[model samples]
Target: MKNCDFAYYLSNFFTTYLPGHLNVSENTVYSYRDTFTRLLTYFKDERSVPPDKLKFSHFSRDSVEDFLKWLENTSHCGISTRNQRLAAIKSFFRYVQVEQPEYLMLCQSIISIRSKKSPKPTIQYLTGEEMKLLLEQPDTADRNGRRDLALLSLLYDSAARVQEICDLTVRNLRLTSPPVVRLNGKGRKIREVPLSAPCADILRKYMQERKLDRQDRMDEPLFFNSQGRNLTRSGVSFILAKYISKANAVSPHSLPSTITPHCIRYSKAMHLLESGVNLIYIRDFLGHESIETTQIYAKANPEKKRAAISKTCDDSSAPKMPDWNDNPDLMSFLKGL
Candidate 1:
């Protein structure tokens, strides 16, 4: 078999094009890398095409589609995840079209592969009572419990993404007058969200107790596991699940069946919308790129809809109608029809 430039193109795409030219975040690069890694593995294990012998010609439209199907049937990936992998492949091909114009037709075919549309996800969130119950599940008496309380409080208050919470450093916090926590969100965007007084106090106490407030430890992680290392996404999920289980055990129907870190963020946004906070403010607070994303909470809130309808309706000014039976002309017209 002739030597192929597939390896070379893939190498430059990740090491140069994505990082230097596109300026995508490290996390995004990792995701794209994973997509290709799985794709190569599929080709090797399924098609018997080893990485070294694989050419750009192998990634045909049908090949890509079959790979997506394999991801669903074999890997059991959801539609959203399949779409994400497809997107990564499309992105690389788009770059390929520019870098290697000779492969333009091939690239165009791969790029034309459309993402599978999934149903709009119903945003899972805790109700006010459920959130209160879950928050109270962590005992504040013990040191670990105190930390858990502060962690959960901050998670809700900032409406931080799980990754953002995991990435938080001691330096990201400012628990002084008018407290705020800096969250580094997706796409390398950073936003400072104000903390509620209670959340601020909890954080301040937790930091002081753990000696995380020291200038020397400013660069250290804000949240840690039992090993005192930065808490992973799985670790955070485990913490939330533990509390959710305890809350559900205590009061059978008080909490949702399963509560993840993201549910806490959604709960905060819902609570804020219910409080009549402006959608624009909620967008910034949640580090959302658009006000449209923040509007989901408003659309989901029944109270807001009820309030809106109540303001438009006037029971006293409504005109009364005569009974059809008593109105001979209307009865005759209806009979004629």
Candidate 2:
């Protein structure tokens, strides 16, 4: 099949069957798109399809298996990543099978390519001290201090994923009786989370300062740079990194490997778990499709890990051991032998 045609079919299948039947979200559709791009590049290199003659049948069971191997050995991709790619490939093959029953045999075998289950990477979050420095790091003496405080507060207040927080518009934020934020999560699924008293007051002050009339047709982003435009994701990351960097100077929380938007994600979940919030509520907060995914942070944390080891293990508590080599009974037996 032509590359363009194949691409069109893939999109159609994702839109029609994926969302309609499988109940996947828009973010999922986006992931499949990325997976296919990687798959094609691999196939092009292997088959030398420089011109326009790579057919769908080029994807045999063995070729698919080889791609799986490449995911680990060559790309060094993680388990979650490899599973997503495998899912995309399976979707494509399933579509082809429906179109051409002759490919049924091939598709059936591809279904057996199971994803290996592994514990998710441990999520890193701020220690209590770290969060203290971060919140306090925003210069309250400056004009942007309140705004910075509000932005950081809102991110943790709702336990929102970074993408969901970045995509917010002015209309999405509500500081009324419910004190809610309308978050557009993965697959464009919208959920409302409550804002704290401090967040509401800070945002109120910032909006009043900007003279942002609700009636005005402002097409710009909700959070603005100094020039007044929506804050880019990278810009937000840089902003957080700035504070994290300063905090790390005082404590180890700001180490390069330890800080990220996702770390903030972990921070919020950890806060909720410690606060005795229900896991289901946190699942809704994080916009995760399942509670199983959210439960990772609810499990034992780093401090808990250390505490567990200390509580359960102690060298002084161990049973005394005999030195059989130096014992007189063993020495006498050896001499007789």
lDDT of each: 0.91, 0.75
Candidate 2 on 246-267: residue-level lDDT in tens? Answer: 7667765455545787787788
Worst 10 residues of 1 by lDDT: 318-327
Off by over 4 Å in 1: 313-337
- Shift in Å, residue 30, candidate 1: 2.0
Candidate 2 to native Cα RMSD, angstroms: 5.8
Backbone clashes under 3 angstroms, per model:
0, 1
For candidate 2, what is the lDDT? 0.75
True-structure RMSD, every candidate? 4.3, 5.8
- Model 2 residue runs over 4 Å out of place are 1-8, 14-26, 143-146, 217-220, 226-229, 250-257, 302-337
Candidate 2's TM-score: 0.79
TM-score list, all predictions: 0.90, 0.79
TM-score between candidate 1 and the true structure: 0.90
